[model samples]
Target: MSFYNMVQSEKPATLLEIWEAISTAFTHNQNEQFQITDPRHGDFTVHIEQYADFSVMNNIYQPRQETLHIPIRPQVPSLLMSFCLSGKPGLSGDRWEASYEANQALFNVFPARNSTYVLPANTQHEDLVIKLEMHTPFLEEFTSDSDDQLSNLLYKATIHEESLHSLQGNLTIDQTASEILAGIQKCPYTGKLREVYMESQVKLLLVHQLSVVHRLQHSNKPDTTAKLTKADQEKLQELKLYLESHFLEDHSLQSLTKQFGLNLFKLKYGFKTLFNTSVMKFIDDKKLQYAHLLLQQENVTVFQVADTLHYGHYNNFSAAYKRKFGYSPQLLRKG
Candidate 1:
């Protein structure tokens, strides 16, 4: 991978300094875009919008390129939410590492020390990042409770100099957030109005993310007594991923027990503890979410979508879809 050392911080670095470091390799382009064409670094087009309390970096990485390394040093405390629309970008240190995956929406806190992020090669990467500074009022409400899950995740990293703070859930970019991102890329407003609109959308996106995270955290009260060993937890995660890819298949808890080499109690309760959802409910939710997308297609019908997802009856599928999305697939098609 090609390497570029980021601007170092004598103290906590601000977004402006980071921008300056990036600007060293990029040249201005038409319509606020910045392009980097160094043969060693690969091809990139980056767009940045920096405001007082928040900032956005919209990056597009072209294909047929080598991985590019950007070493990270300490920086000011901030919360960054990234929507990975395509390709993987990753960060790592000696002991801990994280790699962003396509279709995932993730957020992490930073005043980070001794980490590096790499841009992927061989695939086009499109990611939108919204950074929220901790010193600003934008995050004041979250600071009130030190015991709060999000508050702790966002604040602990700033104070703990040795730890690398990160948290990610299986949060995907749903249709609602995808539309908000589209609005930002095609925003018609100009000047102050443009900034206002963008900020409003950013807040809206965060609200959407928070709602999903809250639902995952609180919906199915976890089995507090269900303790999982590391091996058990990894098996549960593997089961979850299997369900994600094979949600259409009808799965009985008994079948799951045999397939994953887990007991009935662990499959039933440990699933809730780890994912905040029951095994069957999680699969059904994925089915409904997929049904929603199929309904948006030009020639697809609700019955077809239902049948395709292995729904036993189309009417049953319609009812489940309404309960989840607040509308029927038929209604979605009509709209």
Candidate 2:
């Protein structure tokens, strides 16, 4: 079957094993039936559940009914982005519900808990799912100081209804999704050019998302840091080496300046001149580069990398990871 068509007819023999493979590939969670690598940048796994007709028993004594998981919830905090390829999906919670027809999309942001969904008996659902985990930097940038901030941010993380209106561009839905999907597919996109492109696309997505949230009204202005001198570029290379060795630790401007014996202002200015990003952004970028390398290993945990990098917590790390890389740390773990 095409990679995109991989499906679970029934639950896998061992849910954990299946989850492991999915985790290795997609690094995110979903309701049991479907899993996928993000196609946005072409980066994760693809899991699906296709039903010509299906059902389940309810209340311990309803009837052998044809339904998908009648009442299901996602196990992770994700912004579920889906594009309806065909058929219709009936979604309900107590009294409020809606049907999403083919050619439309349903962006559902599921918090830490599940949405009590009742899929209609006759409904057939099909779509491309992009599972999102919040980035640590994003969370830290806006949340570190208070619980109320985190709560408000989390509740509002979902893509707003207005933003989901058909993307207005020359690219078709498949084209846009495929472009992002391709980026995701390029695992370990190394080299300076590749890294720049990867990071750039991610930043674009973030800016796009912020615009959706109305927090960012315009796209980011171009970066205009000065050109780096050859000497500074060499120093930056050394600095990156240091970051690689100490990927799990917190780094600061003063510490780096002292270690390199360079003036603090000069170091900061040179870093921007050379990298076209702030020193902290460069540090975060290197951390992300290392995290991508770690993701190649089968046993690394998302939290481990967070702790190694001195992230206060996994969620914090995740937010930063997403902001810097345009994807989630959890997705890497899934792969």
Candidate 3:
């Protein structure tokens, strides 16, 4: 019942060939809708669709009783964008361990090393992954210098492979990204139209993710006033998690500085650097997102939801909700 079969094969020549090779490496089950044929790999479901310059792989995998690690060596350099819709997968490289959780995403610029993907035991994992091979050189043609984070990252990975190794980082997917991913999944176009739709979405997603990287890079520029140490980065991340869990609680810079033993300047700059948003904006986003969910699912009154989220004034809560979601809470409730 385990789906951790390992298969060793030659590197695939083309993107389509890579998909075919992956399909051929896994076992097929009668009850499963998707299966790869290579018997050494365990049974799993994967749907591969190819476009002009990119390919998408929708994967749902579950290792029966033990964790499964698969080594993938791509013949050509590529940029991979993986969106974790559900489940958690472990990724290990030279000295790092990355766990992709639900609603999170990762962008990787691949070098010439073998990449390992670990699927946890007895748990269903689902991911929407798109791979853009670097052989085409289309990205540079399309992207301008001002908005060239993706292209720049790809160029560095190609020309300076030793210095770069493999560039991998986790990205925080906000509400807009979640909606865009959902739109891609529920695309209604058919035939060539579907391909066009998906290709456009892939580009948009890339741009959005790259913009995040751009912000981080800009914030981390060599400015003495904005620089943060490794410990400061960790402290900022910890504070971010704390705010996420206690979004409804009142917070201020002075209180957070005292609570976390961080200086005011570091508290403010480090937060914006790491999250690409000010602390208050981040808190408001989380609170409004939770309120939106409660309105849609819990059958609660707008007033009740606002009260629970610590919005003392109903009108203020409605205004904030409108600003965030483009509609009033009452309208959402009615709809």
Candidate 4:
């Protein structure tokens, strides 16, 4: 086969069957310490596993001293995404290392497997693996950049070290853990839903992880003269803080423009470009944050906070807060 496609076992698979399938799919060679098992689910046996000293079986083989190496390349070309459910390497020889806890996920494109590979001795590798058979066309659609090349998106050896650090930290499971887990659990890997579900989950996870890293790495980044400048970004941040502080005040574009010496065009574009949010939308977010905080106040009322935040009506504030937090503010307050 040109690529490793989905495996739909007619009957439930055993440990040995799963082992052979995994070996044939991922590693080209590895030490005996490597292991695989059946990850049992409702009426299904998926190849959810962990292995040590994993590498390509094609050429020479190098066994890891302590850490496990996950050779994601199959008998064919593929894209691999993994989450470190637990365990991490203390060090990585590869310039790029994605070290995230349960909150993070990794994305990499595998051209093919090699016979020899090495992993750090200090890091323990335990991860949840997802492999997709080589799909040149689908990859092109998903990738942001156009390139007829094989590259590892998860680990870029030449990327900035600080960005790598932030990426690793951000990949771990965090606020969006439930959404990710739910998406994975619901993926059927068949028919119409297969690609759609897989693509959605992958994109969401990747976007979230990258967004966090981007924020950490360039929180105060300036806008370019050709585009938005750094000063423009700083002004936007200041504007956001101001909105949060005076959410209840009259915040029309005209009022803000007059006070801040910003034109309507600049205000609209600058807020969107710098903060990735609209002016009124950002104001709404601040109101929500305040409402969340106000829930902690023993004597505070939802309507009172809503009015203080300049919500035209109490229901509007409640609905918005509910939509953002997934629960009614009053209910949250009572809790």
Candidate 5:
């Protein structure tokens, strides 16, 4: 095994230097999973599976000394989506650095990319990375007739080296997306069948994330009417992330305003203006949508799911679910 020790203050090593240290340094047994405990590499069991369409890398590691440098070929013309299933790992890219904190889903596309993830000390980290490589024709067909940021990402990366924040999209792993992600982890197929299942599921997950970016892109355009500055709008975006992470908790408008440092009017009105949904409604929808996923399981009853969601009354949860979905909560199980 090979190991390189370096302090954090030094300049980041180039990708080639990193590869010499880690990627081919150790010989792994031909199993679905293997161990990499080469001191500086940390102690981790990794499952790196490559299928016909895309690839998945599942790493469960505990922090040791020295930051981890992962080196490999750049999967270009692809959307790389990463999830921190557990632990709060700190990640910094050689180039495209956005919010790489744990519990956040960050995805972006480029012709080539490099990243280094520093798993926090004393924490158990489980991260799943999904790379959806695309062909020229497939991406071309998908982005045609659209001038959205996604299309802009494809066009910009083709000619330039700079990365934009919007294109380096960061998001919360909401209920539905989480479900899709779970499906990927528990995929049952093997061989070519496994490839097809993974490809389809990853595509679905990408579409789900794209829909979110598309909505937020349009909803957050300068109100032209409100006195909100660009900074205020950015804060509102941050506020949305906060709400998504804590939507199940009981939070009053006053408390939320204080937490986000927005006044009563902007907390209510600006949320409405920027997100196109009231704060309370936004929270309620997230709750009910999560409830929908839980109810789909035959083992869990509606009341049990509602209680887990902190719903004070079963009737209120059911009514809200019915209102949003146009059917009673019981119908999902029956169907």
Candidate 6:
């Protein structure tokens, strides 16, 4: 049987209850730790931590040529933010379907409904997921202290505003977001200090995500500028994946325009609209990501890594790497 099938006996009323049910279903090694190894699912490790009003679940799922589905029936109004560091996970509702890919974030508000989270086959999934139950008192307090329009929209959605159908959107993870997530994952503190650090980082992630939504809303207004069709958006997304996969290749605006069969204006605006980043910056981020991985995981020198990624000068590569990750390649390699 699949992991979800083993644990689908009861409906969980809260996030904590959900974790408890899952723990009961799986072999618990320690507090907040659950593991299940199946032939179909490969291996799964779930760590859930509960705060006063929220919960954070860190999941690492590796599937072997099979898909896994977990059904959730949330019993309260809650906001969910899922940060995808790798792999693609699909979320399907009664009427909608959303896919979150690597280096992207998704936010959605649920109103005590049934939904299914699908982990696609043949991939390793690493995700940091946060669930915040929206009580009336907390929502009021949060809105009163904030001037951001996106926060206001969230408040209205939680209270069931007629103007908004659902609070759901996807955002590209920029440098600031990447750093905050990295801090959360690689916390250097322990005990109470670690808890405090996690709380602050979660709050910061919320702030940054809300800001991205606000900026996207303002930039894509009806009367503001060019509007891309669904097809155009898909094409741009394809281009983004291509760039990520070929980060070491040399690319220029003219080359991209001709290769993608898109005009300069549409290419620039469409990419920015869909990914929330310029083409060149996106490529740079991808390259730095690969460089960091090579330095940490592979047995390679800094100079060789730089050369492989097509850095014309070693100094230039070192400077860009330091700027992106706040440390020199030598330091990262040393560790």
Best by TM-score: 6
Model 3 CA lDDT for position 299: 55
TM-score of each: 0.53, 0.32, 0.55, 0.39, 0.55, 0.59
Model 2, runs deviating above 4 Å: 1-65, 116-124, 134-178, 181-335
lDDT of each: 0.67, 0.46, 0.67, 0.50, 0.64, 0.70
Candidate 3 RMSD computed on C-alpha atoms after optimal superposition onto the true structure:
9.1
| Colliding residue pairs in candidate 3 | 5-42, 24-38, 25-38, 26-36
Scored by lDDT, model 3 comes in at 0.67
Question: What lDDT does model 1 reach?
Answer: 0.67
- Candidate 6 matches the true fold with a TM-score of 0.59
| Cα displacement (Å) at residue 222, model 4 | 15
lDDT of 1 by residue, 186-287 (tens): 999989999899889988887666656555556676434235554676688789889999998878999999999999988888787556679999999998
Tens digits of per-residue lDDT for model 3, 79-152: 67788877897666677667776656777765545566778866778888777766565555544464556667
The 10-residue segment of model 5 with minimum total lDDT is: 22-31
lDDT of 2 by residue, 94-163 (tens): 4345555443444445444433333333334444544445444533344344455333444455423122
Worst 10-residue lDDT window, candidate 2: 54-63
Model 3 ranges with Cα > 4 A deviation: 1-33, 36-43, 93-97, 143-154, 161-169, 220-335
The model with the greater TM-score, 4 or 6, is 6
lDDT of 1 at 19: 37
RMSD (Å) per prediction: 9.6, 20.1, 9.1, 14.3, 8.9, 9.1
Writing each residue's lDDT as its tens digit, candidate 6 over 1-335 gives: 33454344333233334334453422222236555555533666777776666677788877675576667667666767788878987777788778777766787775566677777878888888777777755456556645768668667766772223222445666657878888987889988998788878878887777776666666645411225554555577679879878878899999998988788877887677555678998999999999888887656899998899899999999999999989899998777
Better of 1 and 2 by TM-score: 1
Residue 322's lDDT in candidate 2: 87
Q: Give per-residue lDDT, candidate 5, residue 328.
A: 91
lDDT of 1 at 14: 37
Q: Which ten residues in a row have the lowest lDDT in candidate 3?
A: 24-33
